[model samples]
Target: MDDRLSGYPDPDFSLGTLARMGSSRLVTKAHSLLVTDARVWPAPDERLGDTVSILIVDGVIEQIGAGLQAPDDVPRLSAEGRVVTAGFWNCHVHFTGREWSSAATAPAESLQHALDDMLLSHGFTTVLDLSSNPRTTFALMRRIATGELRGPEILTAATGLTPWRGMPFYVKADVPWVLRWLMPAPATSIGARLTVAAQIRGGAKLTKLFTGSYVRPDQVKPMRLPVARAAVAAAHRRGSRVFAHPSNRPGTEVAVEAGVDALAHVPDETEGTETLLRQAAERGIRLVPTLHMFASTVTTDDGYLAPIRAALGGFIRAGGRVLFGTDVGYMADRETRGEYEAMRASGMSTADILRSLTTEPAEFLGRADTGSVAVGNRGDLTVLQTRDDPSPADLANIQATIRAGRAIFLRDSPSKHTADAP
Candidate 1:
């Protein structure tokens, strides 16, 4: 976050009037949080078979074993034999929906509903919000960072950059002409570079480029090579990752040649994309297939989806890294079962999926303190109940979401949103 910024410009941005959203808040912020009787899956393949206790002090795990103790006044969560792992990360999402337009001053309950519907109930403790009103995004970041809201750790990009004169046709159609100006499509390399630098200075942690954009329902436009390269260079210099929304083969090619760090979505049009995808994999470029997004928003026909799914499988087979994400705010349906089923159908095993959700993102984003459960790591964990053996859907059975030892989501009491004590 931009440290120099004091607070939101909106004088009414925060009224500090939030009612606790749920009655299931088992812990209040105490600089320490304890989870008892948890079956810990510290990593994809490493699971502690027996129930154990996790003791967190000052938002860091201090101990993980039996009979750990804390002060009687400390907060506690009885995991009750549920599974616990590193907190889940949803790498692609948006906060542009109408419900979030007033995030800054809205009652915490109202904002919490949007979060639970889209993210929290699914066990996401961290998310990358690709595009949204920057003001709203910043306000949200401020609220979360200050513990004014109970939600995920959010990283966002500025208004995404597109090809010269190119804006997603679907978006243009839905919005009025004047609003189009807010959607940037710089024509010059210098302009693109400067835009990116400014966004980063304004608190954006990632750069989103529409290397391949749908300028029309029937046409896809790819950003110019020099412009794409310049933007990537600018972001890399700032230590921020560049994510691209490639609409087709040409877009994928630009993404690879220009050195984007990740593909936010698999290019939906697969006719001429395989070779470039292979090249992207060879370059160590990460992919968030978002397979279900195509099914949910475009079409569910096997004819339309089989090849896209095949592309993901091929990428994995080629050793490309995968990040688990559902295009939640954009796709609108919050259920994650279909996404898991689609990835599995594309040949990712349970462990593979787990890595996408946990370790893969942690490694790609260079967040060593997160992505795993350890004594010295951040106390961010997702605890879920499962049957004898866990399945993809079972992963969604969230018991609670803890970030830095504070409870953000409690499935048993989904309506709860307790602001952390300062």
Candidate 2:
């Protein structure tokens, strides 16, 4: 029997009907309408366009020419003086059923629902879930896919694949042990393949491998590499990509040689030379950078954060692609909104930052249809009420977050209008 239904009640609410009702916000005559008088960040490499009218229809854009007009029945939002861009994607995020570790032991369905609420409320309409037990994450994702729940489109990896010592030691043994219970008995040696199969079978879009160890207080250098070429090759055969969490030179070199697809975070403790950057570029591997997480983990010393920023700048200059990844909700001890602020403090330009949070991740995920505003794209978007212009602070304000054309999150919006569960 499927253990998934071992403990359940006839659900009090029909998620399908609720989701449909929530979607009605998008079912307007404005479906085929024009959004005029707004500053449009239309595409990568294009500066902000002058006040323009974007014609949208059936959740896709029909026209973006100047001076477009709205149809008679179509509702015309006074987009005047608002900054409009594509919906944001957090390439490196972890979604789970519990809050701040202190809350729950076993995964809770309500926890999943609440997380979906928070994510949509925060304007993250798409996320690549890098943390969580595969079963729990996918169970929630399947609901969203079936239109039974309103949440971001989810792309997930298996659980965090780390060697015994490299794994997070802080979590009580119960966490890893529960995951271990669900894993195969022959998993020790061939665990990567098993892990990959579990996630792929569960509909994961990618895989995560921890090829490095946590920073040890006494040790001068912390190094480890878990998954190897054979395992990565297996994932490739399964038509999925692997992202390696490599925080040291040896670990990074090994992951690159093994042909992993992305680096979850650039090593913050060490400065990467041009040689390594070139190798990564040649491999066509993208970097998530995840400067926010790095900054939070390490106390600032002279030049500690400097190299991170410089390395990112150099990578972009060297024609390397970058996707914005916040690594949010893994340990939500701190507020997640500060991620955007941290990036700005690191000297990233506003346009580049927005691209990382929006277009680039969409392209990386192969979900080009929902990321940008254009003809035939999904009507997922964000509207920011900026003060002066687009500043990092304004970006974090999150005036309104739209998922599938419905306002799931809005600053000062009515209580019932918001999706945040708490």
Q: Model 1: clashing residue pairs?
A: 21-415, 21-416, 22-416
Q: Put down candidate 2 lDDT per residue, 1-422, tens digits, no spaces.
A: 12222111112222232233232132222234445566776665666666777666655666776778766754444454677777777787765424412112334555444654557556677778775544445455555554445567667774656654454443223343433333222224366666566556545568777665453532222223344565577778888778877776766777788788888887664645556766787768888888767667565553687787777666677777777887775535334456676677656677777888888777766776876777678766766676245776566655655555544455564433323221
Measured over all alpha carbons after superposition, the RMSD of each candidate to the real structure, in angstroms, is: 6.3, 7.0
Quickly count the clashes in candidate 1: 3
- How does residue 161 of candidate 1 score in lDDT? 91
Which candidate has the top score in TM-score? 1
TM-scores for candidates 1 onward, in order = 0.90, 0.76
lDDT of 1 at 354: 86
Clashes of each: 3, 0
CA lDDT of each prediction against the hidden true structure: 0.80, 0.60
- Cα displacement (angstroms), candidate 2, residue 134, comes to 2.2
